[model samples]
Structure formats: structure tokens, C-alpha cells
Target: MEQKAAAKAKAPKRSQFSGMSKALVRRETISAYLFLLPSLFFFVGFVVVPMFICLIYSFFNMGLDSTSTTFAGLSNYVRMFQDPVFIRGFWNTVLIVVVSVPAVTAFSLWVSSAIYQMKPAVRSFFRCVFYLPVVTGSVAVTVVWKWMFNPYNGLLNQMFNTVGFDWLGNTKTAIWCIIMILFTTSIGQPIVLYVAALGNVDQSLVEAAQVDGATKLQVFWKIKWPQIMPTTLYILIITTINSFQCFALIQLLTSGGPSNSTSTIMYYIFYMVYRYNDFGYANAMGVVLAIIIAIFSAIQFKVTKTDN
Candidate 1:
């Protein structure tokens, strides 16, 4: 009877401890949710809400002024496909991405690899120099580029002694000029990321490759490159996205001028919203741009995963 009584007492204590553990877990879960509440609120309020609003607005013929909405039912999307300006803008955007993504990735890789082994101070100086354009606001950088590319009394014209050809005015050269500026701003972060990735590569593997009489190129390609593939993929996606959204420089410098040669979807969207007050059409373009970006990003992710 005494042994039975002792066993019953121990069982109750075990149940009490388990109950306490569950209660503690519940409390911790609630605390974690409370900590996340603020950020969740802002994100849902600002980003999620605005995105849904844009999506809904795309389906209607909405104007800037209130109460002018009518059900568009994909008319805006239909018009977008039919619009010649949008077509030109899309092509221009494609060209920018095609030209810039590879250049930025390759150049940043070269810069990072070259400087990763240098003295800390020297490496930092080079990084700062490359990153300066990014810290300098886009508007400021665009303005400076504008002055440099000016036809008369501009540094570039004076240096080349070609006064008649306007760099930003000529359709053939305006896109190139925009690409150059885009290149400067786009490279900074990628270089930083590459440098960090290179730093984290396994030194022992690199040393072993070198000791085996492997060439520097062989060592890098065989050992280092695979490790940094993630960084490269990240840079590719971001650079592609940024190139597609190449608006500020276009707006500040060319204003998509010289027969819309420098026009991009972003610039076209801004033009529609403010100049034409075609809110529904603008939103439709936005939805399309978002979809395109998502598709490109998905492709990149799939390629990276397959490579890995």
C-alpha cells in the first residue's frame, strides 16, 4: 500500500512538470509574436496594402481625381501590349539589363579579387573609392554626369574636342551614357559582397591547390568560384532588377528624350501617372513590371540551385 501511494505521488509530480513545460512554451511563443507585431504592422500597412491597392487599381480605369473609376477588365493590360512607347521602353530596358548585368558582375569580381589580398587600409581605400558613387545621391551623381556629357564646355566634349555631338541628345549615345552612370552606381555593393565572399573562402583549399602546382586561374575556378556562386547569383539578380528600374538617371539626364530612345518602363510609368494621369494604365504597367521581375528572379534562383 505504501509503495502504491509513493508511485501515485511521483506520477502527479511528473504531470505537473509537463504541464509547466507546456505553459512556458506557450508564454515564449506569445512573447515572440509580440516582438514581431510592430514590424508586421508596418510591413502590412505600407508595403502589402499599397501593393494590393496597385493590383486592384490595375483592373479599373482610375484617374488621379476621385470617383472617375470604371471597370477596365484587362483593357489597361491590352493597351499596354499595344502601346508602341511601352514596347520601345521594354526593349530599352532589356538592352540595359543585357549590357549592365554581366559587366557589373565581372568587373566587381575582378576588383574584389584583386584587392581582397591587399593590406586592410589599401583594400578599404579602393572599396571606398568604388562605393563613393553610391553614397553620393543618385540625383547628385546624375547632375554631375549631365555636366560631363554636355555638348558645350563639358569636360568630355572638351577632352574629345567633339563639340557638335551631344552625348545625352544623340539617340545612339544617350543609352550608352545612361548605362555608364548605371554601371558606376551598380558596382559598389556587388564589389563589397564579393570581397566578403572571397574573404570567407577556405584558405587551406586554396593553399593546397597552389602547392599542387595549380595555376592561379585554376585555383580560383576550381576552388574559389564554386564557393562564391551564391554571391554571384545575388549580384546578378540585383543588378538585373536595378537595370530594369533605370529611371532616375533617365529622368534627370535625358527625360527619355531624342525620340524616346532612353525610355524605360519605370520612366514610362512615371510619365503616365503624372503627365497623362492614367492611373489604371500606370498601375497595369507596374503589375506587369513586377511580374517580369519575379519571373527573372525565379529563373535566376532556379539556375543557381541547379548549378549548386
Candidate 2:
């Protein structure tokens, strides 16, 4: 009887402890949810829900004044393959990446090396100068470049004509002008990134190499280059991404050019959305673009991956 009485008392005590633990766990869960609530709400509202909508839209022919969606099941993708304009846009974008990424990487690396080796104030001023295009108003920069590219009496054409080369006036030279503008203007971000990577490198190691009679070039090649390889890889990835987003400059400067030479994937997407009333196709293109970005990013991660 006494043992049974103790067992009954223990049962109630254990139940009370378990109930308190459950309540405490419930409180912790609620707190965690509370902390994440705003971000979660925004993600769903702005990103997740729209992403689903886009995915579904991609499978249908959703258009303005035609809320009715027709099942197309890869026809849009099929159309994309058949689209000469889209193909040209794709090649143009790829061409920009092929030419601009390397040039931008090289120039930004040079600028970063020079600036990093200078006095702090001088470094700041030059870095600021490079980034001025990005900061000192994007619209004004676009406007200036547009005027510089005018076919009749632009600065570029005038200079080229002076040199007996009508660059802006010639079809072969016009796309290249677009590429140059993109590369030059977007140098800011890469330079900043390179400078950051350069700052993190061990100065003592570099100096030790110099003390060992290593040439400046040797020191940079041996010690500095390997260290900043990650930065180079990073810039490559970002440059590719930004090259596509350079549609703003295209829209402002070329408007897809004298013969659609400057129409990028993003620019095409914009035209589809605004001009063609083709929301489904635009959404499909968006999904494709997103996939391309994700693939490139994954490739970058693989290429730049550290053993650890």
C-alpha cells in the first residue's frame, strides 16, 4: 500500500514536469517563429508566391486581355529555340560575357593592384574615381554615352572618322562599342572586390619574397595571384550576371541598335512584357534566365572551391 501510494505521487510529479517542458518548448517555438515572421512573410509575398505564379505561367499562354490560360507544354520553349531574335540575343549576351568578363577582370585587377600599392588617401581617391560612374548618377552616365554614340556627329564617330575608321557608323563596329561601354562602366564593382581581396593578403609574405631577391613581377605572380584567385573567380561570376543586367544601358543607348544588334535577353524580356503583351513567354524567359544564373553560380562555386 505504501509503495503504491509513492508511485501515485511520483506519477503526478512526472506529469507536471513533462507538461512544463512541453509548454517551454511551445514558447521557444513561438519565439523562433516570431523572430522569423516578417522575413518569412515578405519572402512568401514577394518571392515565393511570384515564383510559383511564374512557373505556372511558363506552361500556359497567359497574356493581357486573355486571362484564359491555354496549356502549351514546352511550346514556348520550342518557340524560344525557333526564335531568331532570341537566339541573336542569347549569342549577343554570350559574346558580351566572352569579351567583357576577361577584359573587365584584367583591367580591374590592374587598377586594384595599383591602388592597393599606393598611399591610403591616393588609393581612396582613385577607387572613388573608378566607382564614380556607378555612383555619380546612372542616368547621366547613360545620357553621356548615348550622345557619344550618335551616328552623324557623335564624339566617337568623329574620332573614328579622324582616324579613317567609321566605328559608330559601321555595323561591324557598333556592337563592339556596346561591349566596350558595358565593360568600362561595370569595372567599378570588380575593382572594389579586388581591392578587398588584395587588402586581405599577407603583406609580410609578399615583402619576404622581395627580401629573398624575388622580382616584383615574381612576387605578384607567385604569392599575390594565387591568393586573389578567389576574387578573380568571384568577379567572373558577377561580371557575367551584370552583363545580362546591362540591359538598361542597351535600352537607353542603342534601343536594340540600328539592326537589333544590342538586344540582350533582358531587353527582349522587357519588350515581351511591355510591347508584345506576352506575359507567359516573358515569365518563361525569366525562368530560363534564372536557371542560367544558377548554373553559372554553381559552376563558379565548383571552379573556385577550396579543399577545406
TM-score of each: 0.92, 0.83
- Model 2 Cα lDDT, one tens digit per residue, 1-308: 34776899899776754646777878988998999999999999999999999888898898887757788899888889899989888888878877887899899999999898789899889888989888866578878876777766568668777534544446577679778877768899898899989999999999899999999899988998888887888888888788767786778777776577878888899999899789889988888888887887787667666521
Give the residue spans of candidate 2 off by over 4 A. 1-29, 159-169, 306-308
> Which model scores highest in TM-score?
1
Q: Write the per-residue lDDT of candidate 1 for residues 105-212, one digit (tens) a residue.
A: 999999999999999999999999999999997999999989988889689988998986699989999999999999999999999999999999999999999999
State the lDDT at 286 in candidate 1.
Answer: 95
lDDT of each: 0.92, 0.82
Model 1: runs farther than 4 Å from truth? Answer: 1-20
